[model samples]
Target: MSPFEKFLKQLENVKVIEPTISYDNYVTIDLSDKNPDLNKELLADAEKFEIYIEDYLQKNNALVAFGGYNEVRNLYKRSTIFNGEDFDERNIHIGLDLWTKEGTEVTAALNGNVHSFNFNNSLGDYGPTIILEHLFEEEKFYTLYGHLSLESISNLQIGDEFKKGEKLGTLGNAEVNGGYSPHLHFQIIKNLDQNSGDYPGVCSKNKLDYYLENCPDPNLLLKIN
Candidate 1:
């Protein structure tokens, strides 16, 4: 079997979410799969909306419920409109997300080396990130944990090994965790491409095919309903 296939086989029957939960009542929006020309009018409007949402969340203490990969996402839904163009709906999320109160304990999914780590703090960006590499059946792959607490990567050393179920870190609060609810964006990557603590959690419609192949749905390993 290929590296990716081997990794998936190793994770058979692993419980990604301890308790299953419904994903209803979540405010949903999509980024344009189209390149988003970002003309002056569209760029300005997007910026304003982004700022408004940021402030609103700060004042309301509301969290972003579900992100990264969601099996329930209606892949057939219409693509979002940016400026004037309609893009394809590449919204069938492949990663698994843990949307709950902040400070949730994030455990290592499996025994692996610290492949990479970084602090990505931007609007709609992963606040803090860690990627672990797993070798199974002589094949190698990686798992990425995003939107984690700052301390998560404080003392992490690249290539250091962590066992499955080890305390990888905790979830960060809104101000530091990309101004959203505290949750983990966990993704399985077949190839690293030398990226450290970062991978493309979101992909444009044009590149959906490539991203889908390179980054398969993590549920294949997690199998959490």
Candidate 2:
């Protein structure tokens, strides 16, 4: 197996998010092309989309709705920044999204030092984002936490340390979280490639192979299911 794959296997014993919400309370959500319920019109209205997600969680008796690794979503089509003339559209989600209510507490997935943090305030962006640098078995990697409240990084400095399960921040609302239903975008990046506080959470179909390799499924660590 590849070294990264082996590293993922070791994460089975790790608890990324808090265990207060049991595994059974976490439900998988699909916003990909396979889910017929997710269309341009449905995702266009932020309120309606939020309601849709809440309703789904309520129906499933779940507290958290999570999934979306390598999912090609129609949600970004409205943002020219994502689907602009600059290049091919970047709609394939490279991270795992945990959909929960706004203000829900988020914790660090592993022991790491703060690498960089910033607020990407553009429409359909990550909003307040934080990247942490971690070392496992002598190999270096990165973990990104996005869609966070401004207060999360307000007092944080580069090199600040956080242990696993440490409360890092709270989920931000649409107003502060780049205009979307509240959710935490978590990603495990093999390499930052010189990226700082921000990194592309989504990629185009043409570059799927490279991104898929660089950003592995975070479920490898969360084990939410």
Candidate 3:
């Protein structure tokens, strides 16, 4: 079976959200049309906002599809709200985002060893992130789960073992999760190269081929139409 098929077979009991929350409901200041500074207060308290998200999930206990960090800054602009930083097309997103509340449970896509974990607490960076290494059918690949709460890595160890669909950590708020809307940025990486807790979630147009080859569409494994 292919990598996507293998991952689908393992997501039998995963919980997810349908009709992900809209981008408008994600931020506080609504920078969709404004040219604000990177540090502008466009988002609210993650902890407080997550309460509603949690309640919504309980009412709509659907299949857990996928989870990771997300941003609504329209990465394709080649320039971000962050310090007027200009980037190439590679800066655009190439991953799937699972929209939900803060503190949402993040589970592993498959059984794997803890490759590395870190607190990437920078402006617009993944607050706390985790990467897993999986070996299936002699094919090795990595899963990157970003924007996690600090406690997620509080007691984590390098090379730790985790089972498929096991709880890894809770989603973090905008303050702690790199100042953006609450969502998971999930990606399937075929080659890790030398990356650690963080990998390129966004890439430029020039580097699209490299990213596409190394990181396939997460939906292939999620199988969520």
Candidate 4:
């Protein structure tokens, strides 16, 4: 196994989100083409899309929904920033999205220091984002929390410390979270390079290999499944 895989195996007992929300309360969601239920109209309207998610959670008696790591999706086609020819179209999600209600508290998966954060105010983007630097077993890595409310980063500094399972922020709605359903886009990045506050959570097919390597599956840490 890869070093990262071994690292994740070591964290099998760690709790990432709030303890009240158990693994049984977490449901897997598919936004990829494999889910034939999703269509253009359903995904176009933020409110409707959110309702769809809520219905799913209610049916399954789940408190939160999660999935979408390296899955190709059509949800980004609405934004020119993603669909435009500036570069290749970026529709494959490299992050795991935890879908829950707005204002829901988000917590640190492990002890880490605030690395950087910023508001990426653009259509179909992460509104308020934060990145934390972590060191484990002599290896360095980073964690990113995206789609957060503005208040989450209002008083945050570059070096703020957070213990494992400590409150980090709250989920933001479509109005403040780049016009998408309220969700936390969590990713584990091996290299941030010079990027701050934000890194590519999605990539094109051509760059899939690089992203799949840099950003490992967050479930490796969460172990929700």
Model 2 regions lying over 4 Å from their true place: none
* Candidate 4 lDDT (Cα, 0 to 1): 0.89
Query: What lDDT is reached at residue 12 by model 2?
Result: 52
Better of 3 and 4 by lDDT: 4
Model 2, 145-177: lDDT tens digits are 999999999999999999888999988999888
TM-score for candidate 4, residues paired by index = 0.96
Question: Which candidate model has the greater lDDT, 1 or 3?
Answer: 3
Q: What does candidate 1's lDDT look like per residue over 91-110, in tens digits?
A: 44556665655676777878
| lDDT at 119, model 2 | 96
- Regions of candidate 3 where Cα sits further than 4 Å from its true position: 1-90
Give the TM-score of each candidate. Answer: 0.66, 0.96, 0.69, 0.96
Per-candidate local distance difference test: 0.63, 0.89, 0.64, 0.89
Q: What is the C-alpha RMSD of each candidate to the true structure, in Å?
A: 7.9, 1.3, 6.9, 1.2
lDDT of 4 by residue, 1-225 (tens): 578867876785565455677788899988997788789998889999999999999998998999999899999998887887578999999999999899998888889999999999898999999999999677789999999999999999999999888999998999989889999999999989999999989899999999999998888888888
Clashing pairs in 2: none
lDDT of 2 at 118: 92
> Where does candidate 1 have its weakest 10-residue lDDT segment?
75-84
Candidate 1 ranges with C-alpha deviation above 4 Å: 1-3, 6-10, 13-94
